[model samples]
Structure formats: C-alpha cells, structure tokens
Target: MIDTKKIRKFFPAIKAGRIITNNAASTQVPVQLLELLKKLVVQYDNVHRGQSHSSILTTEEFESSYDTIAQFIGAPSRKNIILYRNATEAINAVMYSLMTEFKDGDNIVTTFMEHNSNYVPWYGLCKEILPKFGINVEYKIVKFDTETGALDLDHLKSLVDQRTKIVCCSGASNFLGTINPLKEIKAIADSSGYLQPNGDKRSYLLIDGSQLVPNTYVDVGELDIDFLVWSFHKMLAPFGVGALYAKEELLLKMRPFLYGGDMIAEGMVSPEKVAYNSLPWKFTAGTPNILGTILSSQAIRLLMDFSLNPGKQKYFMTDKKLERKDVKKAMDNIEVHEKILIGEALKILGDISSLNIYGPKTAANRTALVAFTCKNKSPFEIAEKLSNLGIESRAGCHCATLAHRYYELNPPASCRLSFYIYNDIEDVRKACLAVKKCI
Candidate 1:
C-alpha cells in the first residue's frame, strides 16, 4: 500500500541512480526537508536575546520547533526539551547532569553497543567525577555469541545493583540495527530489576533515542524514560539541532553544563558570586541555530507519523500535527515495505559462503540495518567494491567497536546497507546484485 512511486519523487538522492544504502551513517535528505532548509537560509537573519522584529520572529520560530519536536516524540512539553547541535551534545547534557547528581559508591550502568558518543563521555565521567564519590562505573558489557551475535540480555540484568544511579542506553545499535527493548529496560529501571531483597528500584533510566525515532513511534511518556536524547539530522532535520527531554525535578537540579549569554538572567560574577537564569535557558548559552531550529519544525512536520490507532489519536504529541491521513499511512506502509526489501537482501546476502551476517537473523529483532563480514575481505574493500558497483554502503567499526567484537571483527568489521522509506525493492535488488558481484 506504500506508493514508492509517489514517495520516490521527494528524495533527489535516491533518484540520482546512486542506490544509497548508508542511511545508518546518514540518510539522504528529503525534498521536503531540503526545501524547508532552503527557505530558511534564503530568508536568513540573525537571532539573539533581543527585541528586534527579525530576532523576535526568529527566536519564536526556533523555540516553536521545540514544541513540534517534543510532540513528535511524545515529550511532556516544550519546556522539558533542550536543543543542542547533535546527539553528542544531547548525550553530554545528561552525562554532565549525571556527573552532578551522583556521589562516590554510586554506580552507573550502560552497555557496549552504545555509539562512541554515548560510550566515551560516561567513561570519561566515570574516571573523573565518580572517583570523588567512590562510585563504581559498571557495565552490562557488550558481548555476543560469536556464533549468533544476538544480545546478551541476561548478562545485562546481572550488572544492575543497589547502588546504581543511572541507566543510560542506546535505543538501537547504529552498527547492527539491534533494537534494545527500551520498554523492558524502562521497566527494569523502574523496579531496579528486582534488585532488593524485596526489590526496590535504584536507578534513573535514560534513553539515547537518536536511532529509534526514525524507525518507529517514540512516545517518551509511554516509555516513562527519565531522559531521552535525539539529534535532528538523524531524524531528517538540519544538523545543528538536537533535543534532550528530562524529568522536571532532574532539570531543576542540573548545574548548567555550558554557561554564557542567554543562560543567565542577571549576572554578578564579581569575583565573589555567580548568578543564573531561573528556567531552561540556564543550560542554553549564547545565540543558537535559530533559523535551523525554525526550519527543523518544518522538517518535523514533513516526517511520517508512525501511529496507526485512530482511538490513540488523543495521545498525539504535535501541536500542529500533520493532519494528512495519507502521509501517515504512506509512511507506515513505506516502513513495512522497506523491512521486507531489507529482509530479502539479508536472505540473499546471509547465504553468501564468503559472508558472515552479524546480529539478528530475523529483521524483526532489528531496525532496517543489515551488516555482514566476509571470509577475508576487509570491510573497506567490500564497501569500496560495492560503491564501484554503483551501490552505496558504509564500512569499518561504525563507531560501534563492541559490535565489531560481537562478530569477532576487531580492527574493522562488516559493511552495512541501511534501508529507508525512499529505498524500494529495486534498490534492494540492486544492492543484492552488487554484493553478489563482490563475492
């Protein structure tokens, strides 16, 4: 029921005969997003904390986008959404806050499947602030059965304990498209995995929602996550913006990670005192990508709505929701078709005697990503060969070194071909042929 024909018209990259398959690295921009971005740039002007007409309009536009994005992900309100440059900034906001909240002997829990952006900062904090608090940084550890490459969930549960203060995790592995059960993870955090003699929850759960929003509906309230981070670029918005949604109490306690301009209402850091703003602007320093944020709203409006239940309509998050029924159905249908196309590609590529598919066997357990290693071919070699064959793919550790170890591919792992709404059966067929030719 997905009209790939009509849908294909919106993405110029897919129509260019390039056969793009590197959406995991970056998705091709839709004409909808592109046009919106173009409009902003053409109508460009500076925006800052001022009373000028242009600044007022621009600031309003930027702040308004937060509401749209909040709605897109079922956030409580625009006030809870903090904008940033990318997932890294969004993750940093939470990481720094975690640093402020915990003391020695407190613990933090995460997995190896996290992108370096998610992994490195926490580790850095563990080495820095955790020591002062006598806190131990524990991990669920990223491991896989070299044979199956499935998630080691049992191992994950073992890592949570009485002292754990934070549970931050990626919603899906960017490398292998492995979808971790956020709902289950949230439940575990809510109850601390029955960690007590009678079982009392001990950690606040945060989700790195960058990858999940594109693949499915993201209702943060439904997920009951304490914090969630997502970048606009990954979700088809401009690259300069991302959002961090956190619980109100946590936000109140957070010391500003970055400080300057807009962050302070009245400043008197006169060698003796430092004053700050009262609201969310405490964390926001200086002028932002006001135009980019404005245009991001336009982009968010243009994306597909993943919900289907008509009765669940009241739970819809957007203030100006995309009222078009056809677009939502088309988006959902496109996702279903893309899954099938990617699955067929997996079926063909999975059997190549020379190739080793890492991660789940069935596509349902994963997002629309398929990664594989070959007998002796370097990941870059395969990726280059596929590129020469007019197919697009990405290679190397994929910022997922743990995923590399999962397949016993240490230095570099496999090539990844990620599918999107614009990708169709022919594109998958072409990629399959390209992979076949590589062998």
Candidate 2:
C-alpha cells in the first residue's frame, strides 16, 4: 500500500485542502516537478541549435528525457520514442505517417470507446482525405457491452478481416474506466491476414494509452505493440508533452509526419538533394518542447519514487537507470492502491439508489475512475453542487463521446470522480459522499 499520509505532503493542492479527484482528465503536478522547472528555467536554452555551455547542458537533459520515457514503457531504446504536443497529436502523427501506406480497399478498425482523438483522425483519413486522393479506405468501429463497459471481442474478431490494415484501440476507456483486454485484442489483430509492406501478415496495432500508462504498467516489447501514444500531463507533469513509441523498423520506414529544420540531417538539405535525420529525430521537426519534455521525464521518475518510497528520492532527480523489476513493483503498488480506492468508491456510490454508475461493477475490472448519472439531477448540476462542497468532479462525455451516445444518454454526459497515487481512502469517501449529497 502507498503511504498516502507521506505522499500527500508533496502536493500543495492537497495541503490547501482541495479534493483533487478529477485525475483522469489530468493529474496535479507535484512540488518536485515545479521546483525542478525553476532550476531548468535558469539554465534553459534551445536544444541542438547552439554551442554554449547552457545549450549543451539543456540539450543533454532534453535528450536524456527520451531515454527515461523509453525505459518507462519498456521500449527497445530512445530511437522508438518521439515527443509531441499531446496524445492527440501523437496519434495523429501515426495516421499521417501511415497515410500513404493505406491501399484502396483497406480498412481500419477501432472501438466506440475511443476518445475523439483516436477515432476522428482515422475517420478523416478514410472518409475525407483518402477519398479525395482516389484511395478508398474504410474505418470500422468495434462495439462494447453497455452493461459491463467491456469490449466485444467476438464482434471485434468478426470486423477484422484481410482488408483491415491497422487496429487502433484505447488501452483504457476514459469514460467507462474499463481497462481493455489488450492481449486478447492483440491476438485478434495478429490473426488478421492483412499483408503489409514490411512483410508482416497481420494488421498493425496502435494503442491509445493515455489513460493506461499513467496508472498501470505497460511493456511495449512484451506486448509487441506496433505503436503506443500517451500524454504526460495525465501522469504528473505539466501539459504540452506527449509520447509516441513506434517500432524502430517502422519509424525507419514510415515518412516523417512533419518536415522542417532539425528533422533533416546536417548539411544534407540542398536544392540538389535532401536527407532526413535518423529514427526519432526524423519525426521531431522544428523546435520541440524542451522544458516540458524534461519535466515530463522527471515526472515519471518522481511517480516511481512516490509509489515505491514516498517522501524519498530514489529515482527522481537522479541519473540512475530505472530497473524493470522496480518499474513493475512501483506500478503494481499503484494498481493495488487504486483498486482499493475504487472498490470503496463503488461500494459507497452503489448504495445511492437514485444514481446509476457506468462501467464495471467491480473495481478489479476497471481503473480508478467512476462515471455515473442521476435520475433526479443533471450531471452539470451535480458537478456544481459537488464543487460547492469543495469536491472536484468532471461532468461531460469525458471525450468518450461514442460510448456516451451508446448508452443513449440524453445529453451524452456523466459526472466522473477519479483518484490517483496521492489520493487516499478519505479522499475517495469524501468524493463519493459528496456525490451522494449532490444528488
């Protein structure tokens, strides 16, 4: 179990008595990251564009940030990692980069539970962009069980055929809080007899891990994930930095999504000929978010430290290599902690006769978030009332618009309360009790 009493001290928001239960949208930044930002600002300089001491130092830190990110996700190396403005942009990068690879009759498979970011790009590519180019591609959406909020694996298998080129799925649903059965999904994708230019006989798998990576352990190598994308803000850092992890071979073959300045090799751009930089950098065009990248990487380290040893600095602010065993242990602890919190929340919220909670009934089947609707109250009204009681809650579709509509929600919205590492049992009790009071 996490030492929430010690861990809560690191967050000024908690100290200020604010109930930060809306962690699914974005987690609160810790004091260490804020302090680290100040130190970084003093010596900050543009990376890879200068030859001064500050530039050299900043560049080293910025580049090392990629290593930290790659290690956290069990990526082979930094070559597989690319930083973006956010997860939406990172997923868009995959769509754009692989745009030319889609054939006239190929189809893309995704789920109704996806955030608009994961679904819309493919929708635009298949319905809008590709059609104009005389390349007709189809986008198929998998269905979920409305009652359990679980993906319909049999339905997904039926949808995926030889014509399917890529399968894009969310690692976890932001609204339903359902942690998808990724292994089963991967097996289904693997069985698709879609031929690829890379000589693979299966459709590619792209996981939108925005909700999964922040709260659970993810091993890209073990999962054989072709592409993974997530935002750092959802974890613990300030906004503006997201990550895309693609196979090195795929990164080497796929064209860069953006092309400009740093993306090109040194002295290789001329009127006669132009050559792009090596893997990863080829995708990182123009000036990147240097400070945000550094802070985001530090946030991963700090998250590990917070989970493994609260009120201590074993990984944060250190140059130590994160051990795989430690990563699993830290993340497993966080998962267990969240299960307990969500379990308690489910029990309390379930007792409210007027409310209907969405997603899995048991905490073991979902993440730490709980989304629900009230019979006598609108979600917005409930959220505002909860806020008046100093409890933070989010009321909306939560970006799982298709899923919200799947439930036939009148307004396509629900109120959500989510927990994180710094949140304790008391926070969960208070948030759920406040929801009861609001209703």
**lDDT, candidate 1, 1-439, per-residue tens:** 3446665666787677778778776666666666656666654666555687766766667777777766667666676778788788888878885575565566677776778888778777877657666765644453545444455666656666666777878888887677788777766666563242223455788788777767666677778888888776765555687778887667777778887877776755567767776656777788777766776666555555322322222322344554334434534664576668768888888768888787678777677788887776787888899999999998888888765765556565678888776677888888987888887
Clashing pairs in 2: none
Give a tens-digit lDDT track for model 2, residues 1-439: 7889988888889999899999999999999999999999899899999999999999999999999999999998999999999999999999999999999999999999999999999999998999999999999999999989899999999999999999999999999999999999999999999999989999999999999999999999899989999999999999999999999999999989998999999989889988999877999999999999999999999999999988899999898898888999999999999999999999999999999999898999799999999996899999999999999999999888999999999899999999999899999999999887777
lDDT of residue 331 for candidate 1: 47
Using all chains and alpha carbons, the TM-scores for the candidates as numbered come to 0.88, 0.99
Q: What is the C-alpha lDDT of each candidate?
A: 0.70, 0.94
The C-alpha RMSD of each candidate to the native structure, in angstroms, is 4.4, 0.8
Candidate 1, residue 63: how far the Cα is off, in Å: 1.1
Quote model 2's TM-score. 0.99
